[model samples]
Target: MEFSVSDLAVARGGLCVLEGVSFTLAPGAALILRGPNGIGKTTLLRTLAGLQPALAGRIGLPPEAMAYAAHADGLKATLTVTENLRFWAAIYGTGGVEAAITRMNLAALRDRMAANLSAGQKRRLGLARLLVSGRPVWMLDEPTVSLDAASVALFAEVVRGHLAAGGSALMATHIDLGLAEAQVLDLTPFRAKGQGQATARGFDEAFA
Candidate 1:
């Protein structure tokens, strides 16, 4: 599915962070968001994922066609590695656990409980979720966190495969995922004016 955002205004905790943000991603393509911390990168991703509403403008693409991966792994500690992938596959109606395990190089740890995995292992499992989501548009936040060089390479490979299969992705990260062809959207220029301004106390009472 193709994705587009037009003149979007994003807010977090009642504070507007980004405004007039716009971009598009066609199938077989990717878009990378680059910015420093506290600059609305995560907020923009979350807004696109429907975790929060956009303050203004529009996000094109059906909510069902989007799959979001937050910074957290969202794994059940008691479940095995394969079990985790299998569970998501069942939910998404996409059976690719074995393939995903192989893709993420988790076959050796397939039987290990999620709680026992290292930080890098947990991050890999989190990334494997995209494979089973069965959704064409991926919204990822800091996907390469905690990965080593080899694992990062594996991630790049799978992402390429996704694009090749007519899937698109929007990723927000400071580090490069090695997506050489992906379009970059820098959020710095769109930062909202007076983003952190606090409302005056007397104004509320006067209005009331």
Candidate 2:
């Protein structure tokens, strides 16, 4: 399976957010979208995931072949951790709920309420849902937002494993994730010419 965006444009409040954005992601590959804040990285990911309407261009993916994890954890505040997973598993049509919970180191908090978990814990739970969903493409926005160093490492490992298993990912992150062969797309160059400037160097500089 593959995901591609062609000449994409998105506007919000009558202002252009992204224009002429294009990329193709293949199985076993990943791309990191980087830029200054408000450059439309999150909007691009959301448009690709079909969560937002595209003003122009196209996003191609198989039916139900993609899964998206937004900045929000989207967890049920009133449900236990296990209950939350079970609910998502049913939506994803997967039966390995227990295995996923274990993989995320959430076994100890199985019966704990999701509302009571820390931010990092909630993010981990969100990541764990990807494993249980069995989707071929993952679109993650700030997957490591509140994660600690160890949790970030764990997330990197999981991403590596996903690529090794022929899955693809599109991620937006402010911090570096040590993944060999990962492609970086710097969106700063495409930002409005005179609006503001990105202090960081280009993608090549950042990756090199």
Candidate 3:
């Protein structure tokens, strides 16, 4: 699937957090959203995932074609790891979720309660939901948070594999993820503008 954000703006209580943000992603490509704290990175990802409404402009996404992984685990504390994944898989209409769970190295924790897991373990479980969802587009917010070096490497490999399989991704990360060909869009330029306004810079141009 392909996505394009044209002059998209997000507002909370009449305060614009993101303005005039625009970008496009074709199949098999990735766009990295980059900026310092509270510059609307999470808000923008939510807007793209349709969790938040855009105050103005257009966000073109295929209907039900995206999977969003936020910083929050979004897992039921009462459920076991396997149970949580099963619930998400059923919701997403995914068929082969067991394989995904195994690939994420959650087999040992499969029967463990989600709330009992460590922070990084919970994050991995949350990420495993993505592998099962099978959505074409992935919007991840701070995907590397709470991850160790090994887990981060695993995450990078998973993302690379996703790109190789012709899927698209929009990721907000503070650290380098070792993505060879990923494009970066800095949101700093858009943060200084007034409410209801927007600014955008292309990844190529910004990096240059």
Tens digits of lDDT, candidate 2, 49-126: 776566678888865999898888879989998999889999989877898787778999999999999999999988
Clashing pairs in 1: none
Query: Which digits, one per residue and each the tens of the lDDT, describe model 3 over residues 100-200?
Result: 77777788889999999999999999999888888999999889889999889888888888999999899988778888769999998777366544323
Among all windows of ten consecutive residues in candidate 3, which has the lowest summed lDDT? 199-208
Judged by lDDT against the true structure, how good is candidate 1?
0.86
Instruction: Identify the superior model by lDDT, candidate 1 or candidate 2.
Output: 1
Report the Cα RMSD per candidate: 4.7, 6.8, 6.2
Candidate 1 local lDDT, residue 198? 35
Clashing pairs in 2: none
TM-score of 2: 0.89
- Please report how far candidate 1 places residue 142 from its true position, in Å: 0.7
What is the alpha-carbon lDDT for the whole of candidate 2? 0.81
| Residue 164 miss distance in model 2 (angstroms) | 0.8
Instruction: By TM-score, rank the candidates, best first.
Output: 1, 3, 2
